[model samples]
Target chain A: MASHGLTYDGCNFFRQRLLLSTLSGKHVKIKNIRSRDDEPGLRDFEASFIRLLDKVTNGSRIEINQTGTTLFYQPGLLYGGSIEHDCNPQRSVGYYLEALLMLAPFMKTPLKATLRGVTNDPTDPTVDLLKSTSLPLMKKFGIDGEAFELKVVKRGMAPGGGGEVVFTCPVRKTIRPVQLTEPGKIKRIRGVAYSVRVSPQMGNRIVESARSVLNQFLPDIYIYTDHMKGVNSGKSPGFGLTLVAETLNGCFLSAEMSSTPQGQGDPVLPEDLGRNCAKLLLEEVYRGGCVDSSNQSLALLLMTLGQQDVSKVLLGPLSPYTIEFLRHIRDFFQVMFKIEVQKPLEDERKGGDKVLMTCVGVGYSNLSKTIK
Target chain B: HSERESDEEEEQGALKWKEGLQQKAAEAFLRQQAAAPNLRKLVYGSVVEAQESEEEEEELGGLFRVSRPQQSKKVQANTLDCSRFHPDTFHNWDVEEMLDSIRDCFVTGKWEEGHDAA
Candidate 1:
């Protein structure tokens, strides 16, 4: 690492740079963050994210200019323990939890996080979606145990948000390399249609409409209706649907849609929301892969940090965010994936061309974990 | 000698159509290759590092600098940082052909040999 560490411009890909810096033990300096905007600086959500990062690690050094345009972060050791955070309502809890998911496994002790804020929103993946898809994806990397769980204690929508979730994860010495090339035929499709601070019938309506679209493909489709009432429901009135397709090879592909926050845009009917969410799932199925699109970065990150061995994962067309993540991985770990495009056979009815990513792990071990 | 010359001319005309056939095929192949593109290059290559040099400010008279609107590049640099991959709008799920395209992805669809639902 250079004495001055890595330097980046702009606020785009903010979490990726900081997360990689923490893992690689490199200092990072970011400048020109919304410098030209009318209100030029970091937003509340980003500051909350920085504070959360500060809480998880010890002896970390963070500096920001008066306008918050420039930021310097020197990451400290991973000291995992119980912590609480009030995530900014501008973004959902998923925004914060995504970073914790990447960093939790390598901590010195088990991590128990209580996060309060919007649990479901349009901009980011909802906590429900991440719980269904990301947790199972992490299990494939051998980070599974009874303690590995994400629980949603309350349901919250966006805007005037009030929701809570508890996430707990066990530390790991080293991640296991995996070969997840084949995502077998999807046997069943399961989903959750949740409504908070709205009529309980909204949940049922969403479930019905979603199943109507999904029933065309498979007979074993079930969507649960969850209606949280009273204090459990967040401050906003909204509903959403999260669908996951489970394949025979234990691969999961998921998609979700949350209603527009109150006073943000035109209100959405539960029926429309459900039908559209199902269509999103079909889109995900069309981009068939061993891992879903939202979790592609997580899968790739674990592969890069796995024990020094070959890890191969078959993925659908790379998203723009994932393409950027691949470049950042190269800069951080010096690991480049061998990208190969696999064209489907003439008789095969698979959706589209698949990309096979193969790389040798850097043999990253949790140095902070105390020896038993 | 005149008849032999005529025969030679006829032979030359007959073989003229084969001219540049190899070159045409090579050009067509190159076009096809360019259409697909190399995924590795798309991911790791063509990194246009943001230039640090600021654009020269326009001076109005001898008093103040005119503030220019931020460019598209500047806007992109400071956009929201979220990881949700929005679906492409090109796919309309209502079409029957579109539905058939991924029919084999489910267990109800055609199964490959030696792979049973059991």
Candidate 2:
């Protein structure tokens, strides 16, 4: 397995394959990416993502066939530094940033990335949600310093992206093992209702409707109404809400709903979007885990690279992406997690069954980190 | 004497040992094993590793096997990689029963005996 590369089918979970390959120093080959579709082969966005990956690494070998159906990636050293990439507008900046957050801490140098593209979209976790939830989750794993930040320089919606975001992360020689079992009670629910290239009143309408739904649970609810205009607003007219439920123990579970990008889908009223987004937050609360569903794989990756000690985390039902990621982690690192279901007590009104994942880290250290 | 009488008592104790003791222990062990769902097996063992090539080779005019892409497990491996966990059935938020299900997750809800917000 060391001499031969791991081969996968399709372009799904494409980032995970490459990210794992880079961290594990294993070559990966993916074939038949959308080979049967009407417009077969890799999309322009995937090629753009590969280009971004190439920009961040050094001496990486990548090969693709003429139809772009098959790709072979021989990962190179993660030489992270200040870099910028023009993200494909098909997917949001959040899509690219998600992969970057995983690889940033293990880089040779601290990463300061300026990503430009759509900041919010319907298909992926938006930038606001990632900033509010994922960054804090990484902090719990001791990946924090003044350099850790995800600043949204501009707000952009899908289709016609003009957004910009700067993500900076400090490299860690070794990740700290965490035992995040309890989520604690949600103390306050904070949210941002943002609208760009739309009526300023749209932001207000979303806040009022969302407040009406979430005020039933807690009084400490504050939804900030942000209406960006002029050049800061992207080319599309859209409004969305990102709700973060902050627990007493600093666990952030987030839910978001983005309006349909202009001309792509049916336009949604700001009131309806807000009400539905608040309901989504309630649904997330019912799922109820220390790490939100979207960041489960990120948390698990940090745990996998921690010092050689047992790390435990309580997560809601594993997302399909996370489940596939677990299989990949086993293939790359030979680390298998002990999963256990923790059913809520009979009298407890908590939502669903939580799975506790336990794994002893492989004690992977960033050997590339220059020792001063 | 008394020592001989005690020896007789020990002999009777050995003869009247607990019946089905071994069987009882085995049943208890089996029940314990069944109670806790083996999560390790669910994660690793449930992964379908066999790449089943189910497609029958189609030969046109007795030459050249036509290779059509399969919509099998291999195809699904290439599905959308989004992390959203869309539940099959969403809870109707308008219903009071659904709202009551997650009441304890909030600080306003009931706290355990030892823990208090104050």
Give the top-scoring candidate (DockQ): 1
Of candidate 2 chain A, the 10-residue stretch with the lowest lDDT total is A1-10
Cand. 1 TM to true fold: 0.90
Against the reference, the lDDT scores of all candidates come to 0.90, 0.89
Candidate 1 chain A: 10-residue stretch with minimal lDDT: A1-10
lDDT of 1 by residue, A1-372 (tens): 335488888999999999989898889999999897899889999999999999899888999999999999999988989999999999999999999999999999999999999999999999999999999999999999999999999888999789999999999999999999999999999999999888999999999989888999999998888899899998999999999999999999999999999998899999999998999889999899999899999999999999999999999888877888898899888899999999888988889889899999999999899777
Deviating ranges (above 4 Å) for candidate 1:
A1-4, B1-35, B46-75
How much DockQ does model 2 earn? 0.56
Candidate 1, residue A366: Cα displacement in angstroms equals 0.8
Clashing residue pairs in candidate 2 are none
| Model 1 vs truth, CA RMSD | 4.6
TM-score, each model?
A: 0.90, 0.89
